[model samples]
Target: MSGIRDAAAILAERLHAFRSLGDNCEFGFVQRYGGVEPSGLLRFSYTPLEDLIRGLRCGFSDFGVPGDLRLSVSAGGTYYCHSVAYNIWANTGHSAGSIAPEALLEREYGRLAHLKGKFLEDLADGTKILVRKTGRDDPESDFARLAEAVWAHGPSTLLRVTEAGPGWVPEPARRVADRLIAGTVRRFAPAEQAWEVDLEPWMHLVDGAYALARGAAPARLDADAFPEVLPLPGRLRRHVGRHREPALSAYTRAVDPAAVRGDAVHVFSSWVWIPEDFAGTRIFAAAGYARLGWRDADLSRRGCWQRVWAAGRLRPEAAREPVGLGMIGTRRDAFWSVGARFAEGPIPGEGPAPALRMPPARFPGRDLLGRLVPRFA
Candidate 1:
């Protein structure tokens, strides 16, 4: 709220599609109206926290999906938003799962770390790459080399199978990696083989650890895997949705909303249904932005909030009675101020501003993967 103009300017650039008000408009811009016929809305302020509360309360009770919304203001007029919601699209895989040895190897996304060249640079920071070589996976490949290394090392020397790229790694470098792997417990993406190595007492990789070797394996480890998820981009530890993770996968924690001097904003495109069980429970989640609905009123609660529009030829002013329907206009000069002061003159009919539309995700940064740039609307 302190640097109102600056904030609007920054947000406006991110939201280039929105029709801008006059250069001197005090408040924010207009909102999206999902309807035919000449219908529109002009938003005085972006109520992020209020919207989140409404999203969760209504979402849990009706939709069974509890969303997170935070809107609070400070004396300095600083406002921020933290929105969380189940990624409807991403929840299916983990809803029910089975983890076998083949599953573990399939998700050995840790192998992505061993990559180099332009391929590595092109990938997102956290993308998991598979170990199986698509280029040329031969019998005398990295896997065979690893088996020999393990047998040669015996019990004294440690055996780790990290390889930079395809093919067999040099023995000297391989030995060095083994030394580092000996004492550490971190799950290194060992060079993979074409076939599975089934031992009589199958050694399970549970939660990135060799379960059978480390004392007695936890009873839960026998299952091989469980519902797991990773925090989305920009979110500290909020899961987009429950997803199947390897038995040796890392755990994802919840990120609490921290006080901020600046504002992180987003908008919900529909009246989200939330259950009652989610009361006072906060979580983080993020994913993709997809349109659920169109109407702004449907997105908010029932009668608690109302969409207000200006009633004038030009951009309408506050304090002035909601007289005419607000659609399009020239600049601020065509409207009146709350203090009963006329801006300039009966400004000429300029035109309608560009229409503002819904973003892809309902709750970004908090409930799903954070969006860096504004796309459609």
Candidate 2:
């Protein structure tokens, strides 16, 4: 019986490793095992898509939750690309709120038009519908097109639009753009919010839209007033000094491997709470980082692992791999790292820290909101 228990432990470690490798490659960074800091809430503008993807991946990988992974990427000159892990788990369940490609596009376009009209009306007078197109051509047209694509296409298109020169948008238009870029709004009701529509889905849509229109995403909206917040940070910090053993133990008890299908398991941490139905019997794990202004009680910390594993286990093939382990949270303000112990080897001693890479370059003329910097010429 002791030998059997040992074997189970070995199997869990191996499975976690396998899943971790796959996740790291896809997003260019590991999910869990990082730290965070308090850099003003407005810092979301300075964050790059690559950094956000890496941070989110690390967070989910650590917690060991389960589900599909989705991200919005930028493409063409004025388009943003949206991607998702395509599989049964992501598609078949009641899991979260999802907008069809057409619906997402229409909703975003309507919002843009509404906001634009408001800004214009507040500034000058006559502002009417001009034209709206969706595609990747006619770079100089007065009315540019924006196309929304999905990552299921293996680099699918998301938002494709043409660039309109200054002549098309006069001085009044400039002020309107400034106001639209700075504006923000929120919804609170029912005393309780659903994770699908109220949180994750809204985050993805709003962030993607901001990326396309403003060149930056919105920082997380505060929900402190809500009850039962996920991933209490204080609980997470306590688990850390003990090398995550206590947290792992609690999670193991919460999960039942017998209920989980497939020979392998994966884990991740995230900022959103995952429903128990998604875990089944899989051995899930969680980790926390301190960067990105995530406190010990931040839901993103707990939600990280849930998000990554959920994405990986969407297919039986992915679930059959060497098993997986991940962590999420904020990286220390300056550096990033990942640590693991294989089933057959001794854990290595601590070493020099890894350097965080510089964020991607912003286009010279583009503002944080993705608008072109005004050029008199």
Candidate 3:
């Protein structure tokens, strides 16, 4: 446990030296394990943190992880992750295409277009100040006054009530909304009254819109917020793609050895910069794996005209040995490589990585919202 903590501290220091801590870059450092399943095929696991570190250090005596292993560190530039989550939630499903009055006001005032960067900066710094209103009177007028106050404050974002009328938002819906607002907005005070806004146990339709153009809305807008679209700090879309696409393929088994429970795979970690839509420095660190089996052993069967589908297919007879291609180590070293060498002989000592993939990176962005609504689609 101390070793892992020390490792984390070292990683933090390195990132700090690299200036990767701020500048809106998401950072992650994790270790992945590969297990030589009972079938002699390799399977990689996502177990993250202490358990993963423990397994790796112990030669995985508990489960028998063998073959090859590597430690991973990564960082990526991103839009404010809270905004990204709100945007994704707003643009998908029922919330899609639904415009907010606050959004209209923002364009009219040009707050987001001109002040987005500053707003994000404040939000990230936890220096954002929200002036709440009782909303006992007209919500429209209250929203207008709130907007003016925010404008006077200069370069801050807005949080408004999504629904109008007398009834409070339903408890579950209110919980979601409060979670989004309180999570996004860091601090707040009363606009017209002396009382402080209820944030910790927040249950209001009002919420912040730091990334309004990126689909800003309070949680009450849609209670069924996609689990994938929750606030996560410095979480760029590219990292998510790596997890869903390539990393996922490693575990799902693009090709599987028949009758074997779990085996026939090779894994490694890679470091590369993920491209950003806007011009800015970015970082990407990841561990990826590939299956080591004949194309004929592909788990998914191709129907008639398989040859047409799989053009340039290698004959199973010609491709006699199973070879899974993978690369491991830091950007500098190919500490390990699989493909030709793995087919020839067994690599010693590293054992297998582990039985689980690293868990998703945790940061302050999701906080309460992640707990309130655990199910994400």
TM-score of every candidate relative to the true structure: 0.16, 0.19, 0.17
List, residue by residue over 232-273, the lDDT tens digit for candidate 3: 122111222222122221111122223121322222111122
Kindly indicate the candidate among 2 and 3 with the higher lDDT: 2
How do the residues 1-377 of candidate 1 rate in per-residue lDDT, one tens digit apiece?
23222222222232222211111111111111111111111112222223323332333222121223333333333332222441111011111124443343333222211221222222222111111111122334433443333233232222232223323321221123332221121122221210111110111111122222233322221111211111223111111222232121112222222311112221111111221221212111111122111121122222121221111121122222111111121121111101011111111111222232222233322225643222223
The predicted structure with the larger TM-score, 1 or 3, is 3
Considering TM-score, where higher is better, how would the candidates rank from best to worst?
Answer: 2, 3, 1
Instruction: Compare candidates 1 and 2 on TM-score and give the better one.
Output: 2
Q: Give model 3's TM-score versus the native structure.
A: 0.17
Which prediction has the highest lDDT against the true structure?
A: 2
Q: Model 3 segments beyond 4 Å from truth?
A: 1-131, 138-146, 152-155, 161-167, 170-213, 216-377
lDDT of 1: 0.21
